[model samples]
Target: MNKYLLTIFTLFIAMSGFAESPDSTEIAIKEIEQSLQYQTGTIKLKEGHGTLIVPKGFHFLDQEQSKYVLSDLWGNPEDNTIIGMLFPIHVGVLDDHSWGFTISYDPMGYVKDDDANTINYDDLLASNKKDILAENQERLNSGYGTIELIGWASTPYYDSNKKVLHWAKEIKFDGDSANTLNYNLRVLGREGIYLVNAVASMDELPEVNKNLDQLIASVQFDNGYKYEDYTDGDQIASWTVGGLVAGKILAKTGFFAAILKFWKIIAVGIAGGFSFLWKKIRGRNENDTIEAPTKPIQEENDEDSTKS
Candidate 1:
């Protein structure tokens, strides 16, 4: 979601790094966690397309509770698109150290993986950084701070056998000391893909990495929708696995709404011209900027040629 005003109060907690919790807030948060009924074992994903096996030492929440926690407790905007969330069983959703996976699926048509092994990620990352740089002015124009793509937190990896692709990103928002971890996993299917994104601060990198394999294994599309079930004449996706990891898909699909953890934007302050201090639900409002005007700026830059 970029730095457009969607930082989780939970993220704020993580960034605060051991800030003492107010007794009332602490008790209220704990009561909220206790109030919900979390699920375990086999869980069906949105629209019965696939299934998520609540992996060992984790718990699952359906869309309702997930939205409440994300928008209400964590300070993310009201995103009705989320199918659910996954949390470590040991951690309270209110815990400062808490982190979880927000789940959603996109039927963007069958994704062909022929280019999987052919991509040069180093070159791709450079291109992505350029895209991010190009969008900063727009971010400022829309009342958000610039996003700094610090590079990959984990290099992209494709599992041909499993029909899944996963990667991690290191991102920094202006005016914040701590960086956000944007971990992404994509599961290809006959009609679309499942997006499993883990949102956390940089300090949780090791734990997230350690648990990724099993997490990737948790999502399984139903028989006819499985990647291997792609028959001739199926609707093909416009982008490939590389595009998913590059954040380009955000413009074309609803796949990775939280990729930048629009929930990661807490406060934004710009020096000259634009300044935004955000403190409320800010994720979905920023989603409007998805197809926001980057190319138009390129067209404006072409003014030099026009004058000549």
Candidate 2:
């Protein structure tokens, strides 16, 4: 009997320990929802994962052109606000070669040129000089071929094609790596994606590589996501240092389904487990209090019987 009672007590203690706590997912979701206010949609928290996707006109990027032109109650386009949809993002991949955009909140952690200079896609486009373009071409023809030029820029190859300026940057991974075709990115068209930024490194990061591919696959475009007039040039063998391209491209990449599945399981599981533990602890504490008074009453009755 004693052995049985001790075993039961141990089991109860273990369950109670788990029941008293909230999981990380539940706490994170609650905090995220409170921090971000949703205007027209809902916030769904998945188990074990801290991911949210606010699909409708949510600005994930917060650069200068990312503001929303909102109309007033009178329905006139008079009020402009910082509008954004919050999507569920996870650290599915990390390391270099994985493609992703810089969060408006993150100040560091991106690719730079050999001179340790950072490239801004917008600033570079606005600052390109005619003399610099000519000098770059001369070097390319002489077989020095050292300059890095992207498809959407005013480079000679892109300008020649004029109609297909939708092509973005081409990066050279390891010249020895077998996955060249897929890795050589042709931003397809300007209608499909927004070029955030690019970072580079020499480490072999499989998870980051996989996630980068996944991110690329998740890109899509809406009805207005088409590019009307643009130019393209012949493919350059290399990209010049300090050059960049950033724009809102079309969303043709297919990544939503995978992202959904991975995070949903994590968020739900964490929240559910935490809530269950909290209830169990409360119940155990109540039982202990109820038994306390009965023990004293039984002791008093035993003393009276012994005196009689």
Best by TM-score: 1
C-alpha RMSD for every candidate: 10.3, 24.8
lDDT of each: 0.63, 0.25
Winning candidate number (lDDT): 1
Residue 201, candidate 2: C-alpha displacement in angstroms = 11
Give stretches of model 2 more than 4 Å off: 1-34, 37-193, 197-207, 222-242, 245-308
Candidate 1 residues 1-308, lDDT tens each?
33222333334544554333345344444555677779999988875399999989899999988876664455343555578999999987755667789887776788888889988999878887787677677656644456677988989899999998987778776665677777778888899888787867787789888898899889999888898888999999877776666544221112122222222222211111111222122232343432311211111110010000
> Total clashing residue pairs per candidate?
4, 43
Residue pair clashes in candidate 1: 6-263, 6-265, 7-264, 7-265
